[model samples]
Target: MILAVGNIKGGVGKTTLAVNLTIALAQQGRDILLVDGDEQRTATTFTELRTEQLGQAGYTAVSLHGAAIRTQVMQLSPKYSDIVIDSGGRDTGSLRAALTVAETLLIPVQPRSFDIWAVDQVAELVKEAREINEGLRAFVILNGADAQGRDNEESAEALSEIEGLEFLPVSIGRRKAFPNAAATGRAVTEQTPKDSKAVEELAALLSAIQ
Candidate 1:
């Protein structure tokens, strides 16, 4: 499967999710390709750290931006069991190109008014992409959600109203385990002194998408 983690707005944890998901898929013994489609190349950096710290990056990593993302990913798709792309924060050629080839697109949104308002832009993009890639499936997952509040629920409700996005019930809370693990080029599930809640949340998300 070709999956893309993207959003029209930044700070939604797109790279974090892409990197972790790539590692998680590799951990499952699958041949995975991690594509750093974002101009920032954060995913590429994470793979570098993983290689330095662990002596190997569990998955293959590459940097492809703009329309090249579509062409290159299509060429490389047959060699890997799964591919995960960390697209740019905003609507760019990379994101647009990714949408064209990815079978599933996961859009992470924080439980905030600004993030909620930004969904419309994403929906419009999805609408356009579907015209060319009719098989694309877009899902919205809540990220950096507050531990205690109605914000999560409210955001889910708002997202459900959006036509093109399917609101995923699973939410990844604002947990320190995410960054703490990422610092060492690890996923929450692979981190030392594991945070059970964080692991469980990530697992649930993986399952939900499947």
Candidate 2:
């Protein structure tokens, strides 16, 4: 399965979610390929850090830059059971092309007005991608929200207002562990194995996608 994790706005945890989900899926013994489509290469850097921290021989991160994105993604489909594509913040020709071949498009959004606006554009892009790829499945997920308190009302309302959208029941809360884990090039599950909100949320998100 090819899962494209993306959004129109940056800093809404697209790459974070991508990396963590890929790691979690890999832990489940699935052969995974994490493609860093972002020019910033945040996901690539995280993979490098993970290699060093774990004393692996080489970096596990991969990149599919420039043209030939569709070809690359298609080639990966048979080799790996799960391929997670972490795209850039803004929409791009290359991104649209990749999404066209993706099995599932996971859109991550934060709780804010600007982020909310980006959701519409991202959804439209997903719809366009679906037009080209009939089997493409798109889903919205709330990230960086306070699940324990009422601080997540705006995001919840926005999610509710958007009818006919598949919103994941799992919402990733804003926590220090996420940033700390990203800094060291490790997923939250590897950083904190027990009683971690990031781990639990990611696991739930993966289940929903499955």
Candidate 3:
């Protein structure tokens, strides 16, 4: 299945979830292809940095932007079993191209009021994108919840704001290990196995997807 991690808002852990989720899926023995659709190339550079920092090989991360983006993704159909696309922050032609072909659209959002409000815009686009690909199941996954975990008031409020959307129960808590490991081009699973929040959350997410 092709999963596109996207959101219109920045600083909402969209790319982080995209990268780590790809790593988690890869570790599960699945052949993964990560498409970096963002113009910033955050995911692509993060993979390279992590690989060098942890001395591990990074998986395939390609920039699928511009006019030929759709063709490029379609070309990848025969090469990998699974594809995870990291979309740009706002609506763009390339992002639309990705959503057009994606089987499931996984929109990662922080459990905050502001982020919750932004979901409407994304949902509208998801509906539009689905016209071209009816099988696309788009849902919001909570990313970077506060210290109180899922029970936090803000988290609850955020969930309430977006009615009828499937919420992934496993919320990735705000942790330094994620960014720290990313700083060195490594995933939390590789950087600190004992601190299992990142891996556990991602594993739960993958299970939810399957």
Q: Which candidate is the best by lDDT?
A: 1
- Per-residue lDDT over 46-94 for candidate 2, one digit per residue giving the tens place of the 0 to 100 score: 8877787887512245777645567888876788878888877775765
Model 2, residue pairs in steric clash: none
Which residue runs does candidate 1 get wrong by more than 4 Å? none
lDDT of 3: 0.77
Off by over 4 Å in 3: 54-56, 149-164
Backbone clashes counted, model 2: 0
Candidate 2 residue 97 Cα shift, in angstroms, is 1.6
Backbone clash count for every predicted candidate, in the order shown: 0, 0, 3
TM-score of each: 0.98, 0.91, 0.89
Q: 1-210 in candidate 3: lDDT tens per residue?
A: 788888888888878888887887788788888998898999988877866766764468788785555787788867987888888886567668888888887877787778888888777777788787788887777777787755445665666456445666666778887788787676677775446776677778878886
The number of residue pairs in model 3 that clash at the backbone is: 3
**Candidate 1 lDDT tens digits, 10-60:** 899999888878887888899999999888888888889989999999899
| Cα misplacement distance, residue 110 of candidate 1 (Å) | 0.2
lDDT of 2: 0.78
